[model samples]
Target: MVSRSRTRPITGVLVSLTAAGLLAGCVPGTSGAGSSNSAGKDTVVTDPAAMGKVTLNVLDTFSGGTDNAWMTSVVNAFEKKYPNITINRTSMAWGDAMAALPLKLKSHNPPDIVPPNNGWQSMGTLVRGGLLLNLDNYADAYGWKKSFPQSILSEHQFSTDGKQMGTGSVFGTPVARASLIEVYYNRSLLKQIGAKVPTTYAEFDSALAKAKSAGITPITLGNADQNGVTQPLFSLTDAFGAQSKISDFIYSKGDTGIAQTGFPKAVSTFKQWSDKGYLTKDYAGLASADAAQSFVNGKGLFHFDYSGSLPLKAGQSKGFGSFVLPRDDGGKPVTTASAAANLSISSKTKHADAAAAFLNFAAGEQAAELAVEHGTMPLLHANVKATGGDPLFADDVAIAQSISTNGTAVPFLDWATPTLYQTINTTMQSMLAGKSTEKAVVTAAGKDATAYAKTLGN
Candidate 1:
């Protein structure tokens, strides 16, 4: 169980994917051959077996406990499934890989396969530089559109101009579908305090107050690391706004999307909760994992964390139960955040057919079972049955289904800008510490978004 996609470092230079029609690059014929489409320019592979001997260099960075272990099993299974292909794999920690991946993708010898790191920094860089294989033809060839929902596949698509996301040619697929923000509560504490699980933000706020007045930490936060703060912040923001409007802003649909939006309201609520003594005051010195462990130890009443930590909750006290954060207005069930890390193919790969085959298998039923066995949510269309024996896994599946059905999955706030993760995390910490005001925090994020949008040529 883990978090996040990436945050971009500052670059004084900008690259353009639209400036030149990049499909005509040095890789192959304008229309691909082996896996080329019927038009003869696009790649088309009807059979991975026909591709013969192949070696795919895969660069994967999902390096954590459950995800890392499950990926290992998936790699073994995939290689076994395709005996003709060998996977030359190199795995790294998330941050280290993010720092090194862009340079590597731009290098002469790039990994044949790569994991999807969402946002402008990783995918956008590759897309803009024309270093990515447009997966449009392959999606049709592989029947991916029939298997994956548009809600999940939207994140993978980018226009050739790189001006839009969520619509256009398919880029790649992620390992599974999961939530980024959720309310994990100590059920015993709720029982002791005589508070029911909240279905709306008002009831939730009341529970937090009740917990605080009862001398329990209402919320356990680990802001010392700065990164984890976005989970709750994102949930709180989405709770106040319409999912569609907020999504447009997230997708950079319009200029004033955030100018008059729900973010400020969420910030105010966060600061107010801190002021009311409902949250830990020492969060600035805490690590997210340590904070989560604190919740598992039953030291805190409520902990907002990524669903990736759900299995970890299984090891904790037996009284833990989780819910996606409730909406402020009791509107439709809306998901504040979902999967960030995904899968992508390299433009330099020689075994496009085998690589595509590996990706298809990765998103298939076996991988779904692997996800469930590791205590993670499967894809929206995945056919998963068990829940890795964690009691909370069912509740997680319910929430994931809820979003897939009635609501939409929004991207995390950090994906809004290259450096916005650092900006928002730092600001949230100061705001929680009472050193920064709500206006300041919102202003910082808005400025980053505006500046980044210009760089994106929007």
Candidate 2:
């Protein structure tokens, strides 16, 4: 599935959805209209016969196997349910979407629906430029306030001026999937190294040492494109630091949030893993997909990635299992997670009702079924069967549920600034290559975030 974070490149075969159908009914009003308490904004046109004939241009990043399959099924089901609406879908890789969406949104004819990555870089910028629609009324009409967890919904919230996040009116919705960054270990590799699945930071470190002592690669990493190192580094940060401080730093909530947190320790520990030869050799030259593939092929003891990126074959995941990054004090689980991809509506579209309908349909029962059937955990809290018969999918569901229920989930650190992605990527890459220290990484990250905050007059 396409990952929500910055490090994992979204890659997949192009899938196009086209249909020929027409039914006439009422045309929706401008921006926000039709909802009773919605201030006459946000059209709540749920009736297929009342929507009239409409076509929506949807640009998405659900490109690869299960992700692609899930999107295709959902689109097909949506069109089938509403024969009056036609979906013109365009899928692209994650990196490509990041590069192209800004320009596309500014074009004379922008797509009606776009999966904008959450944060100041994509959503905030689009909101500021008035390129994205405000979906606050839609949330009210659809009862989304109760349908989604606050942690999940907050990712899509931004102020009217687009200068603040985690607050204000709703602007979008999460992809129908749930996800988090966690550790995936090969059962056979753990057994060979005489290690067990770690339940605490101490045990996790010990297992890595044990694997290294036994001449096995403890963690497989691919950082060539700079996306591979972030997941584990953030996981380690979650383990060693207070999740609150990490959240504060990412949101730029207080003065130098990372100054007293465990971030430096986390960076140092990450460097230690590199120095102790516990990671894959020549990892900087490899891509994340390749490293994940290598882990599945039994080349590494553990792999750090988003839960949905396991790439395991159907019914063949018995040899694999996953665990959340454990707290050092054995506290409740905590990690960085939001939507796999938070979706936004384009302000330039002529069919807000139709686009909103598509988004609502994605969160319904049928789409949830498609999500589970294709190996992704659905956003709705309904109990699900095994995903594609893969046990790891069960683990994914349990992990997501656990975090949403009792554990803490925070936003990604790179969301701190528009340039923080590249800043963290290059800084972490240099540290892993022994060209930079933990302090340097911390300093660089803090500086980039501070500079961005100043521009916002924070």
Candidate 3:
């Protein structure tokens, strides 16, 4: 069972789904054809028998029973419509999924669909190795371009020439949308300390100081996963106006980037918080599993985590509220989003049409409703009202939609850059360990950024 911090209660627990019953039949003219033109144009399936009884090997990063249930529901829906296809789903942890994907691809029983959140960086090696099918041709013919926004579509595309990483061909379908880092607070602790929610960086710092003075730990951080640390740093970087610079340098090789300014500030700020005792004393060794538990047990005042933690929060404590991490210079909250567990089809699949049909259904509106019912934010436009799992989930969704509508929010940096996320996460771990100085970390990252920019032909 997942535990959460109670000092500042959030809302809800993560729920998963497993397979159930089948539903309906497919709409006509949605299947892929066997052959294509020189430009890889029309996707025609000459043999309907070739698509028969197709079993799609699906890889997921969800290990919980609730997640299995939700996935099973989705898979059952797809199978019902196709009737000829079966999804053999395999679930694992995020780390296991990352480490095993390459090895699995080398084996004969490689999965037809894989979920990777790091975007091109995670899938780049596969694309370069020619293991993935270029979905550009199929996407064009299927009219998927009109289905989602360009920015959303670009998340799955990659560039071999390095000029544009998420350009050209599609490789995955986003399942859920999530904000970068929403600050979760313990309402009881805040009230006990007579502290109010902060709206700006200065106010946030003040609140931290107040919490500290009241003998309450300001923040409970779990860096054992590493992502727990870097996620917050990325949010701060975006708030400080450095995300675009780092992103441009990493993905497009733009010259006027924020690597020199925003990134360093973010690193230094995190270090400063550590120095000021805003973070837990053993944060570097803290695991997310225990960190949330500690918070639920009323050990800390605030925590930084994904909006997906809403359900977990609710199951942990009774009173929890969420806020966007306050931005510096009075800027509005600028969230970072990634395709939360995208689905991709294998190029070697014999049932390309069935696979495409499944993906199309998954990306459509009906799937969004299922996702909402399962406690996940849908990638598609939906009118579902919040169930109030975590008050923060609603706040996060509002903030995300506002930023997206105003063009202030961008996709997650890791999703935008190729292989840069691992570097950043590693650097954050080193910095947190006190093995590397902030300057050293930033300088190293800057160099890597420069090299990456060069690769992009800037």
The model with the greatest TM-score is 1
Q: What is the C-alpha RMSD of each candidate to the true structure, in Å?
A: 4.7, 6.8, 8.9
Clashes by residue pair, model 2:
12-63, 12-64, 32-41, 32-42, 33-41, 33-42
The alpha-carbon deviation from the true structure for residue 12 of candidate 1, after best TM-score superposition, in angstroms, is 14
Is candidate 2 or 3 superior in lDDT?
2
User: TM-score for all predictions?
Assistant: 0.87, 0.86, 0.78
lDDT (Cα, tens digit) per residue for candidate 3, span 288-392: 757866876788898877665633534553466777776687866665554456666665565566666666776766665666676665554534445655554
TM-score of 2: 0.86
Against the unseen true structure, what C-alpha lDDT does each candidate score? 0.69, 0.74, 0.60
Candidate ranking (TM-score, best to worst): 1, 2, 3
lDDT of 2 by residue, 332-448 (tens): 778778767667787767788888888888866687677777767766554554554556667777777665565378777777776776777788888777787888998998888
Please identify which of the two predictions, 2 or 3, would achieve the higher TM-score against the true structure. Answer: 2
**Runs in model 3 with CA error above 4 Å?**
1-54, 103-110, 141-143, 160-163, 177-179, 192-196, 224-227, 256-261, 310-317, 329-331, 388-393, 396-436, 452-458
Evaluation by TM-score, superior candidate among 1 and 2: 1
